[model samples]
Target: MSTARQNPLSYDEAVTWIQQFSKSSIPRDQVTASFSRSSGPGGQNVNKVNSKVSLRLQLDRATWIPPHALQKLKTSPLVNKAGELQTTSDRTRSQGKNLQDCYDKLIQAIKQAVTVNRPADLEALAKIEKR
Candidate 1:
């Protein structure tokens, strides 16, 4: 189900929803969030403050997602060799926004991973191919 999420969705729970097909809460302690100075423009602002947020979820330690969901997510591009879900954002100058962007991106990726096309969708696509 697609919900209009308000700003600052719970980062860890977002990950859970992606793979688990549920919006259960993940423990905050399992997430590792670090901020570093963002690259690119913004002149002095870029050089002065750490605006980029690197949010990492330790997959090995994650217990919130169902077993099947974990297996599916592990196969997605978001998971690295270290079994960590890593994402970073500097889309906005504000660290908070960047953090949210990264989290949103992670959720988006999870949604994509779990998506399945139905027979009706395939038939519609095939009809287009016949054109």
Candidate 2:
């Protein structure tokens, strides 16, 4: 449910965008997941099972994200030379858990990239100013 977005999103609007997408709005089709063997400790399972998750979302294909947030997301370090926003998680030995971790990381990164803090309004401050 991607909506039309302002070209330059204000802080409030960006917050709304994050809130909207934070919940399962990112289309699964636009994201690709790859699994690899994790190097961390987990007994024999670590060496044998492919528990690591590497999730990627191509910025261009992620139309569900607001335009301004997408622009900010493009500048994120997670974005690769191929223009894909990537997140990897091997903290857990379960592939499912790792995949969830990847989603959490992706969302957090998007939150950080999109959220811009607006300064306090001077007019509002003046109203509350003490003599």
Using TM-score, give the best candidate's number: 2
For lDDT, the strongest prediction is: 2
Off by over 4 Å in 2: 1-6, 123-131
Per-residue alpha-carbon lDDT of model 2 for 12-119, expressed as tens digits?
A: 877787777763877878899999999976999987899999999888987666677788888888999999999999998899999999999998887777777886
lDDT of 1 by residue, 1-131 (tens): 12332122344644555556532354678777899998955789999999999988887786655444556778878787889888889887899888888877766655654444333568789999999
- Measured over all alpha carbons after superposition, the RMSD of each candidate to the real structure, in angstroms, is 9.5, 4.0
Q: What is the lDDT of every predicted structure here? A: 0.70, 0.84
The clash numbers for all candidates, in the given order, read 0, 0
lDDT of 1 at 34: 94
Model 1 accuracy (lDDT, Cα): 0.70
Off by over 4 Å in 1: 1-24, 116-131
